[model samples]
Target: MLLTERLMAGERVFSAWSSVPDSLNAEGLAATPFDAVCLDMQHGAHHEDSVMRCLGPIIASGKPGLVRVPVDRFDMAARALDFGAQAVIAPMVNSVADARAFAQSMKYPPVGKRSWGPHLAMGRSGFSGPQSAWLDEANRKTLAFAMIETREALDAVDEILAVAGIDGVFVGPSDFSIALTDGKAVDPSLESMMEAIAHISARAQAVGKHAGIYVVDPKLVQRYSAMGYRLFALGNEQNYMERGAAALLADAGALTS
Candidate 1:
């Protein structure tokens, strides 16, 4: 099913956000029950080559592959979609213009100026019938999310959400905390910060758009889930590995050594 369809159905999407630029790691994570596997390129160690390498395993595992591009590179955004990404997570979208551009890049003409070239997306989407119809179908199905991380974005939340073709918004909690506190420690638990996050979600819902958040802590997942967050990024591969290793070592009595 299309990610947007699932989101619109009120399904809670738990995504595995990957920082490690290894196809092996992506394959393993994709094999899990997580709804999606998003390869982080903005801050994580991923470039075009690594993303191409990682896409194969993600596709093979039968999980949707998402790419958080470095910036509002429409060409790269379009390329990522062509390369079989089910969605494009554009970061640092602090204005309506940014959101519009990102959304445009993800869509085709009339909706946006995404050039016609779906080498991988064509086969991956399983539509070998007709190009024109497939383009329309792809335009409707492919998701595009703008990262609401800056104070400017928070101020213009409604306008950004109003932009056509933007499926939803993702909250970058750490950056949001910093933006809220003006360079203070990143604290998602601060009353003011929590209120701001909740306000973002509430505003999105008011306009029929979905709201999501990047959260590593399970407790934060529960907290945000209660606050009506439909999308949750459950940390990265390294974080999972460290947590699992720590638990195993502690259980084996190796931590006391």
Candidate 2:
């Protein structure tokens, strides 16, 4: 099922965040149990070429591929879709205008102004049908998630969610915590930060829109789920490797000792 469909069905889904710019690494991530794989271009090392290249493995692995485009890179938003990303998460969308620009880049005409050039998308999805068929389903199938990371964005959450073609909102908790503390520190678990996150989720839920978040601690998954966050980006390639290696070394040490 598409990530959008799963979320719309009220199923909690987790996506493995990919920071490395290698297709092999992406394939490794896709083969895991995560429901989806999101290539991060905001702080990660993924460039346009790497995103295009890595998506091939993600598609072959039969997992939905998503892209977190760089801050304010609306052009990359459309390109990521064209390159076969099922969804594009735009970072730092602080107002209605930012949300509208993101939506314009994500959806086709009438909804937005995204030009028609989903050649790779069609092939990746294996839809060898009429263009109209694909066009008809594109808007619904392709999701656009606006990031709510700043005070301005959190304040305008309702208005941003009201914008057409915006399928959901993603909470960048670390940045949000920093913003909340006036650049003092990054802490996703602050009581005030959690309260704000709950508000964002409640607003999205009231509108029947989806809500996603980056979960730094696995133990907090249930808590975030309770707050109505159906989608989660949990850990990156490095985290996986470190955890796996630590487990293997611990087992070896036990055996030897």
Candidate 3:
């Protein structure tokens, strides 16, 4: 099923966050148990060429490919879709206008101004029948998620969610923490931040939209799950490798000792 369909069906989807721009790294993550895979371009090393190259392996792995485009990079969002990404997450969407611009780059005319060019998307989605059929399903199949990381964004969450072609909202908890604390700290698990996080989730749910979050710690998954966040972008490729190596070394040391 498409990522949008799964979220709409109320399923909790965990996606692996890929920071490395290598297609091999993306392929490795896509082959894992993650329901989806996202290429991080905002803070990661993913450039336009890499995003285009990396998404192919992800799609070939039979998992949905997603992209977290850099802040205000609406054009990359559309390009990612054309490159076969099922969804695009726009970071730092702080107002209704930001949401509208991001949405405009994601969907076609009437809904938005996204030009027709699903070069890789058509084959990846197995739509070899007709162009009209693809066009008809494109808007619903592709998802656009606006990141709510600032006070301005949190305040305008309702209005952003109401915007057409905006399928959902994603919380950048790390940045949100800084914004919440007025640049004093970068703690995502602050007790004070819980209310705001819960409020975001509640608001999205109230309007029948999907809610997502970037989870730094895996243990907090269940806590956020209870707060109504169905989509989660977990740690990146480096974190996974470091954690796996640590666990393996620890087991070997214990056995040798």
Q: Provide the RMSD of all predictions against the true structure, rounded to 1 decimal.
A: 1.5, 1.5, 1.4
Task: Arrange candidates by TM-score, descending.
Answer: 2, 3, 1
Greater lDDT among 1 and 2 belongs to 2
- Write candidate 3's Cα lDDT for 4-80 as tens digits: 88998889999999889898888889889999999999999999999998998888888899999999999999999
lDDT of 1 by residue, 1-257 (tens): 76788888988989999988998988898988898899999999988988888987887777788899997676778888888898888889999999889988988878888888897877765667888788768877788889999899999999999988888899998888888889977875556788888888998889888898888567887778777889888878778889989999999999985
Clashing residue pairs, candidate 3?
none
Stretches of candidate 1 above 4 Å error? Answer: none
Candidate No. with top lDDT: 2
**CA error at residue 244 for candidate 1, angstroms:** 1.0
Steric collisions counted per model: 0, 0, 0
Instruction: After superposing candidate 3 on the true structure, give the runs of residues whose Cα lies further than 4 Å from its correct spot.
Output: 254-257
TM-score of each model, in listed order:
0.95, 0.97, 0.97
Worst 10 residues of 3 by lDDT: 248-257
lDDT of 1: 0.85
